[model samples]
Target: MREQYMRTGDGFLIVYSVTDKASFEHVDRFHQLILRVKDRESFPMILVANKVDLMHLRKITREQGKEMATKHNNHRTSGSSPSPVLWGAITPYHHMLSKCHYLIYHLTKRLCELLSTTCYFRAHKIPYIETSAKDPPLNVDKAFHDLVRVIRQQIPEKSQKKKKKTKWRGDRATGTHKLQCVIL
Candidate 1:
């Protein structure tokens, strides 16, 4: 699955439920597989801890999730210069509202760490939003829009830099000719 995604060159948003220890472990393994892919730079990753509505059943605490994200971000950032803030964790609205402020706090702390360590996201200050697939007030659309906005901002900057570097040497001659023509 990781290879397939890498071949397509599409950024990935990975969603996993944290209801039990088994699922949490599964997420860890998946994360490792993603990291093993050679062209991981082409693949931006967002880790979503879904079903936060079932906080009572949460086998993995917010701190654990943040720790995993931090480790993953650190590894990815260390390998690449100006590492993009491609690492983040999101929670559902139910958890956000049910007196689980710890979730937000931990996520914020992790974001701060990533910003401090990674140049790409630090400059942009990537957004963190809460969402719920189940509730209207939570507004999954807004969360996704925020993600899209960040991606749009980064991808274009990368492409623009590449475009500038690839400009034809003849462009200067053309510009000179146009100026002479105008003067004549």
Candidate 2:
């Protein structure tokens, strides 16, 4: 049943209570399951540390939660070159100062984001949001909104006039694959 839900989900909101350490431990499992089910190294997911209102009983520190959320920033980079952000841009003599300034500003911002442990587009890293889960629900709405934005960012535009008919399969008696539906 969990696998079925994972298969159909376009995005995921992985929530763990700050008062429970076991929930925090399960974060890695859920993340891995999402990757495995999607058969992709990266997916649109938001790690939410909920129950932030109970600060006194928080078993997980803010730093710990953030570190867990960012654990996959460098998950896999096999044979990949440096990111464009890290590369210096070439410009004319007059534009050198402006480019340098821009570079400095960008780098500083990135550093701050990483240090603060909350980021969107921080090099394919997952965004982490803290939620209170109380009456007001701190950041709960933002978490969902951010996940939607992430999903939107990942979906490719359909430029072709002709649409492809997507096919899905269901489990068979022998645990083999069989065509379940072909919806146009």
Candidate 3:
């Protein structure tokens, strides 16, 4: 799967059940394999620990899942500053600011919170959906849709040069030709 993803530059959504220790171990091994492959680093992955209804039989605890996420987040830091959400607070605010500025500040804070949460989830390669195949509250189709949304959100857009199209270059045929030759 990793090889196929690497070769095609396609993302993957891997869902696994963690009912037993062996299955959990398989997840760990696959996670390590993903890290080792290195080529799929940019590919999106949604690691779902499904079948939470069978928690009585679960070998992997929620805390273990969180720890795995933390490990991945730490590994991918790249010496950059910690996420704003992780930092917990921004600089001190001005007392003279108007209500509109206060509202903007709060809005910005909320936006940062959302971004950081999403970043942490993607960085850790952990996307969990608690669902049961039997007596399902959220159906399989919805779960898959959610996975796609998460994966799409996780994929960071690459910086590309913007080409100016004047009347000469606006010809459909010429634009198509240029697009065909432009390599990513």
Candidate 4:
């Protein structure tokens, strides 16, 4: 049923509590399931370690989270190229909703920047932000904005690639230009 639900998903955000080792371990299984279900070599995904405010209770260190992300980033399906995996830490200061919003903004920016350097295009970036379950209003708003931005960025690139493919087709018919368009 989960695989069926993910069939139409454009991207995925996998979250785990920083204080829960079991949750963190389950991430790998979820990732594998997604890959097996989608049958895609690479896909946009973000792994977030939440509840960073409970630093003393954190069972998953920041380094461990990063390592996990890196492992997934290097993974490929059916001999395809590696995919990009972005990870982040977020503390949901439920007592102060405003602060949580502010932190989410900063986290979004930083994570997006880090994603820019990866093999994925600017449009393929997956955003990761941390916010408490209690801070519902702001977290939802910010998450929506981030999702919109990612979709917007990808739209132009897809159009441009389409145009390029059209040009390549024209060249092929003319016999004056030799080229190929490989859709991946």
**Which is better, 1 or 3, measured by lDDT?**
3
Better of 1 and 4 by TM-score: 4
Tens digits of lDDT, candidate 2, 30-77:
667778998988887765555567768866577654454557452210
How would you order the candidates by TM-score, starting with the best? Answer: 2, 4, 1, 3
Candidate 3's error at 40, in angstroms? 3.8
Q: Is candidate 3 or candidate 4 better by lDDT?
A: 4
**Among all candidates shown, the one with the greatest lDDT:** 2
Name the runs in model 2 displaced over 4 angstroms: 66-124, 157-184
| Candidate 4 residue pairs that clash | none
TM-score: which is higher, 2 or 3? 2
lDDT of 3 by residue, 34-91 (tens): 5556444544454444455665875446665565556565211011111110101111
Candidate 2 versus truth, CA RMSD in Å, comes to 18.9
Q: How badly does each model clash, as a count of residue pairs? A: 0, 0, 0, 0
**Model 2, residue pairs in steric clash:** none
What are the clashing pairs of model 1? none
TM-score of candidate 1 relative to the true fold:
0.46
lDDT of each: 0.38, 0.50, 0.38, 0.42
Which candidate, 1 or 2, has the higher TM-score? 2
